[model samples]
Target: MRPTVHDIAAAAGVSLATVDRVLNQRPGVRRITREKVETAIREIGYVRDVAAANLAKGRTYPLVFILPASDNSFMHGLHAEIREAMIRSPSERTSIRTVEVAAFDPAALVTALEKLADERPAGIALVATDAPEVVAAVDRLVADGIPVVTLVSDLTGSRRHHYAGVDNIAAGRTAARLLGRFLGDAKGEVAVLAGSMLVRDHRERLEGFAALMAQEFPKLSILPVLEGRDDPELAHMLVADVLSKHERVIGVYSLGAGNRGLVRALKARASSRPLTVVAHELTVHTRAALIDGTIDAILNQNAGHEVRSAIRVLKAKADGLAVIDAQERIRLDIFLKDNLP
Candidate 1:
């Protein structure tokens, strides 16, 4: 049989009450008695299950998820995952709260972090707006001994404990390769559309895409990136205008959200120019677009998996425990028209 507190008392020549006092570090137990119980536990290889102990003691970690108040499909999906985690929070011993700030506003994000620091929750996770002030705020929280994790978009050069997102640079390079190979030497100007350059993921994706395109596909020229602010209307306006003017633009790459606008613009293009389009995130619109042969390929990351990872890492950090790196690594997913999931 597995050794229990009774075994420790029997081996240490102590009463059951004395064993409990020693194991729980109660004040009544003497140092010598504690040492004897400890020795007995070591000899018997007693292992305490932390989850069960926390449950028995009614210990809960209060966690906060700071998100952007955007109308993006991916953000909605992320919110859904957090809600799912909250549903399981009773059994998981977690109390989760969500805070939304204006998207792409660094000052708002810093203000939120400072307020959260004052509240002093056990852990905080955010969709970081990559900026100097935001990094400073994150570092301040870390210095205050708070476990901070960056979710989705990350803050560059921040002291955040973990990032629960995919390798955006690799995702971007992959998008470039897919678009380039799809074009197959029929090179022309490739127009780029983006939500914003304020987030690390979008910037990293653009960096990778441009670098690989310049190094390998020199024949295909890249146009200036159109900032759509991830708004469907804005994206549609920009893409539709670009399509009307640039007759030679044969390929398009959307490295951020606002794909709904992109799809609408592509469908409404005045010219029947064949454009090989590549985008990110697997959503209802993106799925339909891919199936209908509008977007050539999509690179995606599981938002639900990222949210779960952030919570796991946060709990581990709060308890001063090490997390398995393999379990925490967020992987990239590639999808094509032939394979949609």
Candidate 2:
């Protein structure tokens, strides 16, 4: 039989009220008393059933998710996952609020975060922009005892509790290696498309791609990175213009969203031999392009998994519990034409 609070109190030679205070992490218990209760708990191997305890206390975590307001499939999918979680809120006992700010706007993101902080939610999960203002806001939240998790894109030099995203630099390196292998010994230029430099994910991917290209494939020249802002029309126009300007371009690496624009541009050049195209995210457009041999490879991060992981981490931090590191680690998924799921 498992030991109960009664056993813990008796073993610690403490009153039932003191045992409750220590167990629930309530204040007023002295350090020595708390240690005594903790020692007793360990001796009896008292494993807390968090689910049962939450149910008993009727505790519901209030969490906020801040996302970019871009018309990208990946963002839509993330919002969908958050909605799905809200549907299961009854059992999970979580109230989620989503706020969408202008994409790639550091000032706007900072303002949104400040407003959310005003409400003082239990936790906040956001796709952070790499800016001093944003970092300061995150640090403020941490100082105020509100746990914050950086999702998808991370903010450096901030007091964020956790980051629920893939290793973006590694993802970029993988994309570069795949492109190099696919276009072996090709003497042509490669065009890189990204959302914005403010985003850490896009910057890290560009860094990795540039590093690998310089080191492994020095023969191939890379064009200036075009900022599409993750907008479909912007990406399409930029890609078309770059293709026209650089006639020898034989490879394209899109390390951000806006594949719809890329698809249109590549399809327009159907008469020419297909370029070795690589992109991020396995969206509807990219998936179709892969099947039709338009995109050679895709490096993807599951936005659904990222959103859910952020929720779990925020909840665990709010409750002052240790999270299962392996469970919270998000993996980068690679997809090919043959494996279209």
Best of the candidates, lDDT: 2
Question: How do all models score by TM-score?
Answer: 0.90, 0.92
Alpha-carbon local distance difference test for all models: 0.90, 0.91
Pairs of residues at least 3 apart in sequence or in different chains that clash in candidate 2: none
185 Cα displacement, candidate 1 (Å): 0.7
Q: Can you tell me which runs of candidate 2 are displaced by over 4 Å?
A: 1-3, 12-18, 21-52
At residue 240, candidate 2 shows an lDDT of 91
User: Where does the lowest 10-residue lDDT sum fall in candidate 2?
Assistant: 46-55
Give the per-residue lDDT digits (tens) of candidate 2, residues 199-258: 999999999999999999988889999999999999999999988888889999999998
Error at 234, model 2, angstroms: 0.7
